[model samples]
Target chain A: MADSIEKVSIVISKGSLEGVYPGLIMGNGARMEGIEANLFFTFFGLDVIRKNRIDKIKVGTVGNPGMHMPTWIGAIPGMSWLATKMMSRQMDKIDIPPVREFIEMIGDSGGKLYACQATVDMYGLSMDDFVPQVEKVLTVGEFYELSAGGEIIFT
Target chain B: MTTVTLAGTPVEVDDEGFLQKPEQWTREMGEEMARSAGIEKLTERHWQVIDFMRKTYLDTGAAPSMRALGKTSGVAIKELYELFPKGPAKLAAKIGGIPKPRGCV
Candidate 1:
């Protein structure tokens, strides 16, 4: 019975390049615990499932809370590009991988990754835009059906 | 609340949500996480990233940035990506058994 209750589902809605990691981590963690895990990528979150752009997603440093204070502040007035470059450079200095790699890792794991149908339509993104491994393009209600009776996490 | 000792001090985590005692997160857990993340073996490179992440968390009270991890581990940016497809934060948080990080929220 305890094993039966181990399944979990997660909904990922953040479109920012930086926001994708949480969903990937949680989904992978659930699988590690022997829990059935599914990830629904909606709205901008679909960027992660996008075939080409997924690997190139960058952290948004201008308004991101994690950026260095001075750079973040300076970026307030036409310095956003600089901030993005500077932040990217700093991240490179440390050895953190890019955002796309994380998304790919989540897919490489047994976790199911889905793209939102509505977002796909709105963005005029075709199936070709998404990675070949994506489980499907699903509606919100469909996602809810998959999430029923399981932990529903939004990341 | 259940109290688990870390560095000789008691750390309280919610009884229900807590996965295990901090020290009890053994090599098995690490291996399990690695396998789930599609990593086949636990190599010295993996340990380098994990140890750096832990130390960074301890020092700044925050997860280490990718660049910081690269600098500390001497791993190239591209290679780190290959190692952790979900990036450092995801891999670190999963293996470290820390809760979802704040910024990630």
Candidate 2:
């Protein structure tokens, strides 16, 4: 009876595990609902699709209030690793896939994955640096063009 | 919630047309629901996925996620989409007379 969302374009800008998963989950959910979904990874978010770094993303224990710990403790060495490990275990229990598998699942479900061309250029990275699921790299203008009639979500 | 007649029997369904009482489902009702979802015919592959979904829901009290379905449904993800276009997990769950999946992934 009411209008339904037909398309969604999500921008992933932060490199932390927390920052990337939200966008991935949203994009995957959109595709599950039969909506056209696009994931545009930019700036630090490029790490998500980076072949070398994607699997190494860690939780930002330091400077993150969600950690619910004293900042000094969070800044301690090995704290982020412990946090990441714990978080990953929790996610695994709930059947959430790891980052690489999640991206592949999204791709398999027909959601588009894109890297920001400007970031790729600035970082001296090439398409080879990205996972194969990344369809292409697009500039800001191209991203806007592709997102023309859809909701743009920045995470 | 609403009640709709499928294959001549009335069943309770949610707003998205997923069955609220999945136990009320029958193969005929599944066929009827499939027709409404745009699958004019339910091939053997469709029944495989639907059977998997229904069995999983009954066993676990929840439908399997798309990833789980792909991993264990004996149907590849790409072909699952081909069998039930658009949203394979969502559409299959609906036509299989199960509640809509609650997970984001």
RMSD of each: 8.9, 1.2
Q: iRMS values in order, in angstroms?
A: 8.6, 1.2
| DockQ for each model | 0.11, 0.72
lDDT of 2 by residue, A3-58 (tens): 99999999999999888899999998898888999999999999999999989999
Best by TM-score: 2
State the lDDT of candidate 1 residue by residue for B3-105, as single tens digits.
6543344444453223244455555666666776688786877777776766666567666544445456677544655666554555655566554334421
Cα lDDT, model 1, residue A55? 60
TM-score of candidate 1's chain B against its reference?
0.65
- Per-prediction TM-score: 0.52, 0.96
Worst 10 residues of 2 chain B by lDDT: B77-86
Candidate 2 off by > 4 Å: none
